[model samples]
Target: MGTRGQSSAMGREARDPRLDAVIQTLQEIGNLMGRQAQERAANIAQATEAATTAAVNGNQANQGQAQLKPPKFDGKGDPEAAPRWVEELEKAFEVLGCTEAEKVTLAVYLLQDNANDWWKATRGRVFPEGTAQTWAVFSENFYGKFFSESAKERKLAEFMRLHQGQMTVDQYEAEFARLSKFAPRMIDHPEDKA
Candidate 1:
């Protein structure tokens, strides 16, 4: 119920009438600044909300477009007759000098055929009539057809020492190609195995 001398929330002594005029102007400036602050806060909230909504909308639209669009394809031409891995396998085959490589090459071109017969044909060594030594027979049937005489003797001696005069069917066929680099070519065959 206080009137002219009432204190405000700051609890200072009530302003006098002459000073009240200055207080009233200061109060008006404070109200104006408060209103300006409220207006600026409202504008910032609206702008932030609008930016968030726009970003969400943009993300949703991008996701929808991505789902609807087909993948970009070269479709340059029909694929080659075989997959590219086949070519790599063929290249690896060239470096391999053994029966497995030869058999694998045959199988690939034969349209998924097996080399059962090729294995069977070269399976056992045939000891020729004239020679007591079975090594010559092993060489002719398994390795390149003709080996130089010295190369033949060196190989036969190694084979006898390793196998102790007994050889398995497929044993020498595997190692002979790798070992025979020093062994001269017994026969000259064309590169064209076709």
Candidate 2:
């Protein structure tokens, strides 16, 4: 009777094949789930890093644009003032890294009094509905209204007649710089400009 009881205890302690299979399967599932969770965490971290980079870049661009302070134009000064204002505004645009479309928009915003009125009248002619707006188009129109052909001819003549005689070196250089804009073709090369 003691031997029978021992045998019964041994049978009770024996492992089942089906139960062992089930345990192995559960461990495999847990390992697979762990790998999947790690991958998901890595993907989320990458997306978060990308978003942070884009936000920082956007903030930097906004800060640069904010620092720009273009001068205004009222179409009431010397005809040369028109070209000078355009030059100043272009420098501001370069510093701000503005797009061509942005250049036209910002340039238009700086127009005041007669200049604004001129734009209002000329806008339709230059930028008909459905036409793409560009800095070149805006510049052509603005120059047409403010800087006349006659004024440009006068500037070109002044540049052609420029001489260093009698004037100080600095004065001659200043006058040359002032008149050079009218004849860009003549000074297209560095040596020619010099």
Candidate 3:
């Protein structure tokens, strides 16, 4: 009975170091897993925060755009109406901090009746698939369609023939300002404009 007890005690002593090593390994593995879990959770949190920020920014932009009320164009009325509509739309775009794409999109959205029909017909020709839709391009197409060369030439001639003779100072200044838009190069310098 004594020998059996001593052997059992020796056996337990021999297994103690192995048990301790297994326990240490298990603790190390658990710590590594915990760290990995923490890292994954942090990544998820950051991604969620980024997504929320993007959504908020998008909503703010939408709100800003919603506040804007650009005038509609029907491609009728005075020939000068085209330039006036463009000017108003440009001002609105400036206030809204619109990108070039946004400018074209919003301008197109404001088009009604004949103007909308014209854009629909011209869109395919002006902007092919995979081509960049730019404000400059749209402007060129719009001016080409609405503003005739004859009308531009006539305005230029009128600007060249303008004079302050027999007119009030205010009237002359107003007339000069109105016609000068047709010949920008003629009054490009401030001294020349004066």
Candidate 4:
């Protein structure tokens, strides 16, 4: 009976040792898997953060690059006129691709037409900062370059002729009436106000 009891105890010990080994192995595997999962999560988080930063930076750059000048029309007689005309004009001539100078120039001309030379009286109101010259202002307003040089010269000569009090009122009126349809409308050329 003593021998049989000893044999049973031995058998139990042998089985238990195998079970302990299996549990230990499984625990080790679980720990390793947990570490791997943590590493994977960290990597994914880092990638996502980088992508978000890049997207935000790209959007910021685009906003800066897309800067365009605003269109201008003279305030004419409006007291609370906008100050964006010259600002927009500068941007139009900027090397940026998003600016349009011609429309802004025409808008400025229209404003001058409305003001009927009153704009010059309020030069501070119309041209806040820059003391822009007439031809330069017109040239920069939209054309971004010089006007048709010959046509400009001819027009200027005619303007001088008309303004020097050489032409009769009727002749000047008829000639200007013809010019009104096609000539670049001026802001403060005494010819118009006369």
lDDT tens digits, residues 73-160, model 2? 9999799999989988887766545667768998999999999999998889999998988999899989999999999999988898
In model 4, the worst 10-residue window by lDDT is 139-148
RMSD (CA, angstroms), candidate 4: 25.1
List the candidate 2 regions with Cα displacement exceeding 4 Å: 1-67, 189-194
Off by more than 4 A, model 3: 1-68, 189-194
For residue 21, model 2's alpha carbon misses the true position, in angstroms, by 42
Ranking by lDDT: 2, 3, 4, 1
State the C-alpha lDDT per candidate.
0.42, 0.82, 0.80, 0.50
Can you tell me which runs of candidate 1 are displaced by over 4 Å? Answer: 1-16, 59-194
Residues 123-161, candidate 3: write the lDDT tens digits: 999999999889999998998887777767788788888
Question: Which tens-of-lDDT digit does each residue in 163-184 have in candidate 1?
Answer: 4135465776655543443333
RMSD of 2: 17.7
Residue 19 of candidate 3: its Cα lDDT? 82
Residue-pair clash count for candidate 1: 1
Show the colliding residue pairs in model 4.
73-107
Tell me the TM-score of each prediction against the true structure.
0.23, 0.61, 0.59, 0.24
Which window of 10 residues has the lowest lDDT sum in candidate 2?
61-70
Question: How many backbone clashes does every candidate have?
Answer: 1, 0, 0, 1
Model 4 per-residue lDDT tens digits across residues 49-80? 55456556777644543343234454343221
